[model samples]
Target: MTLEQNPALAPVSDLPGPQAWRDIGVVCPFDMALDHELWRWMPDGVNLIFTRTPYYDQPVGLDMAEEISDHGEIQDAVRSVMAISPAVVAYACTSGSFVHGVQGARNLSKAMVSAGAPAAVTTSEGLLMALDALGVTRVAVATPYLAELTDRLTSFLEQGGKSVVSHEGLGLDRDIWKVPYATTCELIRQADRPDAEVIFVSCTNLPTYDLIARMEQELGKPVITANQVTAWGALRLMGREAVGPHQALLQATKG
Candidate 1:
């Protein structure tokens, strides 16, 4: 029994070789609660490595968004994930990236690249790219933020040369992730307008993966969510496509 005679302990032949995982680093806000939603957009053989910015006790608001988006904090977070040498790093917070403005979003991506990420994408920038990919100019936006923050998103979109035909917000400063899909659907309904070519559901913490295709069918327009665009943009930078089956953004042919 001591001479390697245990049948249960014998190695099996034809074992698969080591997996070749394509890693994408994700830098999220401390309060981000939808890592699973991000994963839903990833294709097979891809892995998402997430690291969060330092926690801030402040409620989710302009100040909180600004604090969590600090360049130094984000750079540090990017460095924390650099050991894995991710193909691209994505800053996966919508409000944090857009709260400052278009240039602010670009700065965040630049900082991540400076911090050793070969490439970087911020959610706000991703939204712009999604709009471009879909060839849409007028958009309706739904958010779980206050009027002030929601207004900032409108301005960001305007700066990107997209018209914000209609927009709505829930005015909540925290617990955005806890929002139910029914409520979010109603918000989208309220935000949607006849002139809007597309509808954007902002806020990475807000859950919208299960609602994108449904909402698109109901609204008769493409629906792009924060997490969806973030993952799409990151994967596109790596010359890969995201895994949203019926989502228009994922299926769009970029020119």
Candidate 2:
């Protein structure tokens, strides 16, 4: 009758031991699609839980009032999915995540916990963690957000003890669909700073798969994009890593 009465509904333990398959929840915009780039080099068996805000119209500015308005809808979707009891959940908007500054980051995590997934919240904000993990302080950035949101990101990173040495923003707001793959690649080429140790391609909506390898090579540095860091932090919270070359960090822990 209920899942509790059916073995198939329960978690199946693997041979020789128990390996948990945890879910990582993402709350983002509905019109946007999941780019496999998140797990590009990730291992296997990890899962994703995505919830998106129903669409609405507004200016592209990054004002606090506008930011709060957008997040209201996005967070509503997040709360609904969080009711599902995910292991960890994060609000996936880079611009929205940091709109309130560092406090916003803490608040988003707190919100996820309140919604019932008490593990952690990973954001484009979490990329800061990845940068810190990689020992990057001055970095390059790329984004699909408008100038307003990009400005907030600059402030957010500066507050984090890092500096955005150089950056680029495409100035798109409601429709992230128009950010062409070639344009995103060009943004990387143009925004990348020669002296920077890390390049942060800073949005989740723009597909990043095509440029990751090239960006690493050109900059001669480790590049951590938003989705990459988002995936890394979420998978780590889930206690599993998908197996693939994209998992540059988690591969060492697979033993």
Candidate 3:
């Protein structure tokens, strides 16, 4: 009955075969409807499993932010994700991750690890890491959140060492997934400043995977989106090279 003598309990080999595949788990908010967008950019042989944490469809405001960041719900989601035994786990929500600030975000990731995730990440933490990797100091932000949430996002970035040269929001709380890509493009344009180094589009529910390269081309700078950074960070945690569509952040993998 020793594990050494039991093939069933043996560790998987590094040998390349059918059983060799990477699994990335995501803890998404219940209100989010755009997890498919992340799948569009996932590389081959990598599987993404998502567990939706409790979230109200009500407006994305302070109360909603507070509710989504509940340690209990996050822990529950982490436990659910752990059941899949993924290589890494990510809390793929922007406002929820940053609502309690940077320290809170770290604690969220730690919670995931304590819940049995091999590694952990959060959307806000991913955004900051992506920005740093791109060596971007000044940024423009566009979000589907209301003014207060937008302000909180800016503050989070600012406190993390990035300057929010410009920021704008649609003041939206409902049906964020319904927001057209054209509208997000315009919001980024409006938020773009003459000296902004990059554009960041917030909200995991927002459709952004397709717009990243095009927006970067038009704006002549990197365009980082919530889902993009979340995926990138999780892939990094798994020690895999960042792959997917042509986005500036994905291209800049060093550091």
Candidate 4:
């Protein structure tokens, strides 16, 4: 007998709830391994549908960033999730958005919109929004990128009219998700300075959900991360708040 005809099976119309109250489409890099981290910022009653750029054998670098950020690749990724009708689509890769500088990041957002996303945001754009929301200028940065890649981020920040007071990097080309909390904490410590107003932990794949509040307490300054800001920006486009209890960026958005 067909499953639909089985007496033990419930009818499709008997399902209890809608797929979600709201949905956000996310386009991530092929090597993104920490999907749970992105979900941590999603509020209840909302859902995240994800897609990825085509896999590349090259390690994470300027070349890799360029490849993933290609308008064609991003447009295709965005199209894959258009069926969900998400309120907004986010390109959740920092280097990909920022590697080509300020205009490049904006182009990435436009690409998503052109591909049928109602709205779009990129991690680099989210970082800028987080900074503007907090009304701070001097920033410190921590990353798991090589010196060259780190410099590109600095340039991107400067192009957006923010000064990079100090920065540190782990110089890894791949497996940024594998960096431990202690090591990440140390990197933040090394990157922080009295002159800097906020500390930004770059890279969505590098976990930071559990560390934002603790690090803010330890450093006596607000801390922001890639995934945190990406979710925040995307949710904000939909007139919703991201779900972070003590995250400084989320708290700033509260009425």
Collision pairs in model 3: none
Q: Model 4, residue 226: what's the lDDT? A: 96
Which sequence of candidate numbers ranks them by lDDT, best first? Answer: 4, 1, 3, 2
* Window of ten residues with lowest summed lDDT in model 4: 11-20
Residue pairs that clash (backbone atoms under 3 angstroms), model 1:
none
Stronger candidate by lDDT (1 vs 3): 1
Per-candidate TM equals 0.94, 0.80, 0.90, 0.93
For each candidate in turn, give its C-alpha RMSD to the true structure in angstroms.
3.6, 6.2, 6.8, 4.1
User: lDDT values of the candidates?
Assistant: 0.92, 0.67, 0.87, 0.93
Q: Write the per-residue lDDT of candidate 1 for residues 1-255, one digit (tens) a residue.
A: 652576555456543446799999999998889999999988898999999999888887789889988999999999999999999999999989998899999998999999999999999999999999899999999999999899989999999999999999999998999999999999999999999999999999999999999999998899999999999999999988888768888877543
Error of 4 at 236 (Å): 0.1
lDDT of 2 by residue, 1-255 (tens): 786586566545533345555566777655556545554644555556777766546654575324442544655766787766677776665666777787778777776566566676647557777777776699887777778788888888888889889989887766565577788878877887778767788767667655666656665676666776777677667665534443333333444
Candidate 3: where are CA atoms >4 Å away? 1-19, 55-57
* Ten contiguous residues with the weakest lDDT in model 1: 8-17
Give the number of colliding residue pairs in candidate 1.
0
Q: Candidate 4 regions off by >4 Å? A: 1-16
